[model samples]
Target chain A: MNSLTTAFFIAAAMILFAGCYMLVRSHNMIRLVIAVEVVMKAVTLVLVFAGYSNGNTALSQSFIITIIVAEVVVAVVATGIAIAVYRNNGDLDLRKLNKLNG
Target chain B: MSASLATLVYAFIGLPLIAIVLLNLPNRKFAEKLCIGTGLFVCIVQMATAVIAVLLLIEFNKASMSFSQFWDMHVADDAAYFSVDFLSAVCLFCIGMVGAVSFAAAGSTVRDKILNYTNMMMVLLLGMNGIALVTDLFSVYVFLEISGIASFLLIALYRDPVGLEGAFKYLVMSAIASAFILLGSGLLFLEFGSLRFVVLEEMLQAGVYNNPPLVWLALFFLVAGFAIKSGNMPFHGWLPDAQTGAPSPVSIMLSGIVEQMSGTYATMRLIDIFLLNKFTVVNIGMMLLALLSIVLGAIAAVGQTDFKRTLAYSSISQIGYIVLGISCGTVLGYVGAVLHFFNHSTFKSTLFANAAAVKNQLHSTHYDDLGGLQKQMPIAAATSVIAGLSTAGLPPFAGFWSKLLIIIAVWQTQGAFVASVALLASIFTLAYFLRIQHKVFFGPEKQRPAVKEPKDGIAIASIALSVVTIGFGILFPVLLLALQTQGVL
Candidate 1:
């Protein structure tokens, strides 16, 4: 792999790791969604890099489109659920929503 | 006839989709009847297609064929390919049957938001059917997410605190899983310059990838993604609540088909393609994960008192069994795993449907709140008993033989430690299920408010499933022969 590709890989991996960490660490619902989106972006970046390096831009571009569409739907539904939870419990805090414990 | 069978597969997928639009027509007065009618229509088409597919398989003596190959020239070169094989057809059959049952068993739950519920159910089924039939990695990911989104909405259908909370948990975790899948697929695409499973299988078989480290990383991500989606232990926190809180029919769809399609089936398909060539660290890691889920999930289920909650925990434990069977890396193990997938969907969905029936009757699912219900809801009680026994792996039931196959496979592959744990887990499974049966269905009548029999739709659904569970168990040799013919064994 070239230095530029290596750099892109490193950047994407770091961002992805950061997003996963935030997903585990964040207590707020909306923040969790943001963490997920961050991770998604990192993945998109990787896909783009793969496309560039392999010269399969069209396939990768289509994949990116699919990802974006799926991402939007997930985000919207998640936001809607978060809003519903907030309306019911009056907060977006996930810890408080633990009524159905083992 | 061949052309018609291929078209049947599309009709099986498309009818539900079309029903989604038709159910949403502007006419309000006939909406409920329209919903039921469309649901029944889709169910009939699904069953008819399943029977014909089986007949075609028998007539041809072929294991698998590309149903979409005839149309390949019409679509773009990059368009995804679909095949109707033994496994995919069986998966479709189960989905179609359970889906039909769910629609029939839905009773009053979908009555409130009939259009919305039917739409989401059809979307979920379409996604699931796609997952079973699609031939490439990207399509799997797309379809997995499609089904995942449908499930999240379905879980939140009640709009209550518990329901919304369950939905959010599912959403967050699924998002993480999807990220892993995307990253893994990207790595594989980089390696092969194609997203097709057949290509990846060939490369792995040939050991063509130059960078072993990246391949390992990609495999890890893929396995992790599928494991999370399957609701395996440590990654299964979302499942219990989601299963417990979703409206009952939604629970049937979620627990019955969605988890199987997204988790176990996907994992098996990938493992068949990638890990079969070389048993690496990924396989060992998966085995460890499987053992962990097997033991821990069973132990955890013993403590849950809520009815659906216990079933949810039981699902995790059972999933562990499926994973463990797959990890054994033996053909016998594969048979066990796939058979367990089929058996579990039948019995567990029946159990959940029964729980829904009970909930509908008594408006509660807590263990302490139910008792002596046999006289009142004999169908629920009887079906629950059969389903419970089948789930716990009682002899003469579908679950028993599959669990036996897995245990034998593990004994041969992983030795006595894992085998013993699996055997012991079966006992725990029986214990917990017995507890549910005794406390909820057989004990002295609790002086509670009287409730009516569970609705006929759910009762009929449960009965149909119960018969299949018993039939499959008794006729397991035939299934084995079919599997052998399909080259699965």
Candidate 2:
């Protein structure tokens, strides 16, 4: 409800929306990953703002720590998969990653 | 009773962890049978735990007039963040049954990396059980991540081009879902200063939040997050690829259990927490999405030439029925939804197992590659027919009864027009399945060479599932009575 808190919330939502837009637009696998990470960063910002607004900073901090750990694992695995896909298909474009079409 | 139910939940959660460690004994050489034996034992124990949980829940419900109050307080008093009630107990039962059956159906498919496969599977089971039992929103997110990672690994088990592609798609979508969920949880925590489901439910019921729009924003994010996780319409791009790309048994688990738990089950839990009091937005959204998936998935399935792809689309269609049932927001609708969930898992796993059997023999499941396989793989062929009929909601099969209940529930709530359309969709379901049967089982024998039957494990698994489908339908009254006793009806 404070002006600063409201500003943070607005910024967080804008960043998340921008990241999602990028995710939808990009076909490059690495770029897609970056977009996802950006969204996650926005989420982290929201969580921080949440904790601040709710006066539960410790809980939100712990949640952010766990989220970071999990995010790292997902990022590593996705990067590995992206590299494998690129090596196999000769590109990182999702449009080209279509060997198993419906 | 409450204390023991809590213990049972912990044990159910712990079972898979134990299996994970046991399957990964560093010094010991693991024979295929030994690894499978371990998996089977763990699965059986999971089912046993579910059975006990259900029985205890029924007894507790009978003994207490204030079931929800006791249920809410029982585990909130405990420092641990897990709990179980009738809904969770039933979900655990479905998870156990589907997971066990999937392992049985896996059979020889996992012969190469039996230890690794079984370990990952056990971890997946752990994650699902954890998701079902946990009462806190953060814990749900944590468990969802656990299962999500396990599924990505399992889908990419072969590490081939298609597998990797499928896994990447799954990862990207899942990561987006996670972000949405985390953001939603953050908003919710800001509203209530807590992440516990009970606390949130109380706060919502008490109208404690200041900003209604923020509450709606959180609910929207959560619902969208779970809708993506569950593979609803317009967000189901990863499902067909993931199911088709994974090994058949993994497909069985993915299509049958994982989607239900992570997607529908999780969505249902959230609805209970946040949407039950104000049903207009979530209910209407879920209904519209369900209708879209049912129609589109069926139509898309009708055009697929690949056997697995057809099944994948069919899963989307069938999951639509479950969602449709839930969207009605009536007790009859809930029963129908839960029953359909159980039946879908049964028949879908059966169909996937048979697909694996076909793949095992032909090295492909394309319509062009398969013809008149009934003579060669009679058990699989027969079971596929049964499963196909069941999936189409034919008479004397589990799918029929569940679909009937769901239609009736929809008629009562959403009215006759929607229910009638749902019934028409079943015709689409039957049409495609019959086409598959004709193409794969009754077509002219293109190849005169000897056709091998399904291996013993898959044969037995499919047969068992087929029998259960038929038996559950025939014995619907018994099941209804049991559910009635448990206060689910």
Candidate 3:
């Protein structure tokens, strides 16, 4: 693989592992949200890179990157709600909210 | 179709999504009206676009080209992409149709956050459409999250504690599934350096991975991801809670068709495109999962007293039919899976409308709490019949023909034993639906429904959806022809 593609996948892999670790490790809702962002970012990085080496199409690459930035607000909207969830419950240890488990 | 079909295609996927942006705009009152009006507008446009999409599918099928050419890879000159055929059009119609009907019905009930509800609904439809159309692996993953998160939020719309829990559970399962894809995508990245399903198939066939175990493991991870999303068998724990707790409109979307779109599309794309070379075995495993889903879903339904929970299990059974068809792997099987997916969307959503209506009228989702609704909401009772009869595969209903097709197709290859098993499963489907209908609608007239019926979009969509169910149920032949043009029949 070219250095560009190799570098891209390596960083994406690191981001993904880090995100998963954070998602598992953090009980804080905000941190979880940020971790989810890391997952999204990792996917975006890997996708753009894949588009670059594989599809090699300008439209697909640009489109993938644009989707990354474009999705922030929507993600944030959900995060805002998550924050509200934290406020109401006093903690983000999601296991405590078991009302729906039945 | 011009290269610009992508543009129109993008619009069909973008409009509802753009509404999300519109919702946050100034003036709360306008946001509500705009959301409803925009939802209705998009529904109409989506239905129209669905029609055009069907036409496009016919053209593409006639030309025998379900693959589109977008761009190229480094070593690979022409990358493979998907073009619409019957399967996608059917889903597109359901997504658009149910969306329009339900949004029109849900009006004003989604108070306080008009723009948010409307925007989420549209964006949900958009993500679904993107999933159905895009053949790109990465694109599918992105859209799946978009749609899935939108769904989670819709369930959380009521701000009930249960809704939050529902969202969290769904989020966790969905996150795990997405990670599975990323793992596979990462591996595939190292191998093919590409993510397009069509292109990856060729590379893999040429033995790009070189490790047979790696290939098997990738397929397992990928399939598991989709299986989790589709809620197949053991992975289906999230459906009842998530679907029941979500808003009625979201329930309609989720139960009616969202999972079918994402879950089935992912499973199918992985099986058909990535491992078409190994589908004989893979499909058998899928078939086994289908049978298990049918039995467990019905058994699970029997235990549920909640009206919406019962409907959720029914969805599990409904998903079984689609998976079973794919398992058969004949042209008939593919066609059956596609049509079953579509039919489930129509009737399931209609059924959820009934459940939603009952819940709205009674303020209770428990079936035992809701009695004699027929006297109170005759339309819900009648429409519930439409949904129930159609889904249970009674004669002259849309589901009947599809179920018959699945049975016959299965019989052709698997012999009388499997066909008999299929026959028995349908009976189980009927038994539970009949039990629920009787308990919820036909039971003795009790005190007034526990909750007052809200003047909301549920009523409007109930009528609209009922009309669709009856219309499609009766006009089976013409519908078949339309689907045939798109290769579903």
DockQ, per model, reads 0.81, 0.80, 0.24
lDDT of 2 by residue, B430-478 (tens): 9999888988888888765677894678888888888899899999988
Worst 10 residues of 2 chain B by lDDT: B62-71
> Please, what is the TM-score per model?
0.96, 0.95, 0.84
Once fitted onto the true fold, the runs of candidate 1 whose alpha carbons sit more than 4 angstroms away are: B67-80, B275-277, B481-488
Q: Which stretches of candidate 2 lie over 4 Å from their true place?
A: B1-6, B31-33, B62-80, B275-277, B482-488
Ranking by TM-score: 1, 2, 3
lDDT of 3 by residue, A6-71 (tens): 887788889989998998898766777778778867876765675576665564466466556545
**Candidate 2, which CAPRI tier?**
high
DockQ class, candidate 1: high
- Second chain TM-score, each model: 0.95, 0.94, 0.90
Which candidate's TM-score is highest? 1
Pairs with steric clashes in candidate 3: A54-B73, B105-B457, B105-B458, B106-B457, B362-B451
Clashes of each: 0, 0, 5
> How well is each residue in B1-489 modelled by candidate 3, as lDDT tens digits?
455345445446667767677677758866666777778888788778777766765655553123343342122224435456556666777788878766765753455656677777876887888898776777787788789878888888877877776776677677777767765664565456566766787876666665466456567767778878898888897888888778776787788777888788777667566555354666677788888898889878877888888889989988988888877867777777777777888788888877777765666787668777776677788778877888888987778878888888888866778778877888788888888877888888776524444556776677766676667668977866865786544
Model 1 TM-score (2 dp): 0.96
Q: What is the number of residue pairs that collide in model 2? A: 0
